[model samples]
Target: MKKITNAFRLTLSLILIAVVFSGCLIREVEQPATVKTGGEFQVKLTITDKTADANAHYGAVCVLAPDDWEFVSGSYDSQVGTGIFLFDSSAKPVYGNIDSVLAPPAGMKWIKLLSDAAFTNPADVIHEATINLKVGQKTGDYNIGYFTTKNSADLLGSLNMSDEDNDNAWSDTSMNHKVTVELAVGVEDEKVVPTKFSLDQNYPNPFNPETTIRYSLPVSGYTTLKVYDILGKEIAVLVNGSKQAGQHSVQFSANNLQLTSGIYFYELRVGDSSASDKSEFSEFKETKKMILTK
Candidate 1:
């Protein structure tokens, strides 16, 4: 009887140890290796489990930009309150039970995450979030915060962790994983704005008889610009030839053709370089709407 009782006690102890070890084996979350100002960066939160029994509920993650940065757009999973945004497996933004924007920036960008779903199994679940931030040209130091809930009731606390340390605890009472990012010289300052090409809007938007269109080029190349109706049907060819870049204009007179009073679109295409010695020509195209009030 004593031997049987000892065996039972040992089995119970081993089972408890295994359960604790399994819980701590959740997948590690990681931030992007590189990101650019005014560009999109992917942030992933991965939860790995093999038993399908290890689940997380009311999970959330947020990226806090530096004081000089600003938030442009984001892909969130679920929204609990004001400053929070939510996203799903398909990466679509969805507003949750919360309505008011929780944390409005006094002068900078801030993002938050909130959810209430209960996890039932141990499976690797990945939550991908995209955020566009505008950073200054100067190099500096920045910090990012990651938070999540172990259970549903603590969702709000998980959304508020931002400080350096709370015994490694976040605002959501979850494990806090704070990361520091460094900005290098000449890394974030370079800007790329389209140059050497300009497409202008048509004059007299709502015209009774005619209107004019204009475009400019910086170098010589084969260029083509054509106009199309709302149905994408070709209507007029404005310019089609190899011409030197600098400045050029085209006038589309509506009197000659059978016309309708509606919207129109246009596009321009530049061909590739034929030889390695020559630089490839850049292409620029834009569309403008015209109205025939007649």
Candidate 2:
């Protein structure tokens, strides 16, 4: 009887440990290994609220970058991700410059994006953010940091402290992530921006199930990327919202679509977002074909 009681206590202790450590799950969706001297580098983050606290919610996402990367306030494009962490009806991210008495860890700076997203109930919510940057002339391997919080108060105790020692730096293992990027020297631009609109063909022309599509925009606009069958029926809407001016890529897979082996066409459409009708077309209405084998 005593052994049974001890086993019950052990199971209860393990459950408590899991509850204490599981807060949010942040994963590195996509990133670059190397970038040109003044070229575009991208990072995609997938964050899910696991604890889903009813008292306070997470509405802000932050990035910790090396100062030499020169991630100035006006350097890169900050577009609203077409995810649940939206700022308004049109889905734009509220770019904020957090400068004052607060500073990030030495040699690093924080880029905070506040949204109207919530974990109001007990359900888990997922949010994604894609950040595109044109790094400076500095060339070397550097680590980029990422985190999300409810507000500034949760971050006050984390400044400059080592991640292993700073309990307040982040809530769980997923909240604190580090990504390394190698930068090479090349033609440096005064500011990083796409020169024009372009739509590259799908990679791995004869992919069995998965492939990637790349595109670029010189300016911010309402854009849509779609995949169609040989007969022109829409199969998937890859992107349909406002996109910041820079280089971007999206992946397509056939596992969920139950697609058969054949030729497929993908189209990219962009227009001036200021007008009521954005599909009138100013620079791009391009389509390309790719082959998928079963």
Best by TM-score: 2
- Evaluate all candidate structures by whole-model CA lDDT and list the values in order: 0.40, 0.50
My TM-score estimates for the predictions, one after another, are 0.32, 0.40
Model 1: how far residue 141 lies from native, Å = 41
Q: What is the alpha-carbon lDDT for the whole of candidate 1?
A: 0.40
How far off is residue 68 in model 2, in Å?
3.7
Which runs of model 2 end up more than 4 angstroms from their true locations? 1-22, 53-58, 70-106, 116-121, 152-170, 173-294
Clash-forming residue pairs, model 2: none
Q: What is the lDDT of residue 250 in candidate 2?
A: 98
Give the C-alpha lDDT of model 2: 0.50
Candidate 2 lDDT over 206-226, as tens digits, reads 577888888889998899999
RMSD of each candidate relative to the true structure: 18.1, 18.3
